[model samples]
Target: MLELRPGCECCDRDLPPDSADARICTFECTFCVDCVDNVLRGVCPNCGGNFAPRPIRPASKLTNNPPSQKRTFNPDCFPASR
Candidate 1:
């Protein structure tokens, strides 16, 4: 199951479970569209893989499988993994 991470790993932007702006790499490293497009250039800083829109879990399902409360932020701006 997707972790449904709560925030952008790059900018620490609040990415609520249903946010369309959330993008994720294969490793599920999450970032906002702004970071993916302008800052990261379509690349994931942690995993290097190109990002795709994170799937929005259905509201009904969110109750059963809630979004992750754990926030992941990488402030060091590490190079992309790939």
Candidate 2:
């Protein structure tokens, strides 16, 4: 199951499970559309992998399969150590 993350890892902006703005890498490193396009250049800063729009969990299934509350924010500035 996909871990529907609650926010963008880069900007820490809220990205609820149904948000259309969420983007993620193969490693599930989440970011907002703004960060993914402008800041990240459509690649994940953490994994150096391409990003794609995150899948939205359906509202009916959300009760049983809730989105993750465990927010994974980016604590470091950009140009993180390679």
For each candidate, how many residue pairs have backbone atoms clashing (under 3 Å)? 1, 0
lDDT of 2 at 6: 92
Please give the lDDT score at residue 65 for candidate 2.
92
lDDT of 1 by residue, 1-82 (tens): 9999999888899999999999999999999998888888997767668999999999999998999999988877644662
What tens-digit string does per-residue lDDT give for candidate 2 at 1-82? 9998899887799999989999988988899998888777877777789999999888999999988899888746355541
Per-candidate TM vs. native?
Answer: 0.90, 0.89
The pairs that clash in candidate 2 are: none
- Residue 35's lDDT in candidate 2: 83
List per-prediction Cα lDDT, in the order shown. Answer: 0.89, 0.85
Off by over 4 Å in 1: 78-82
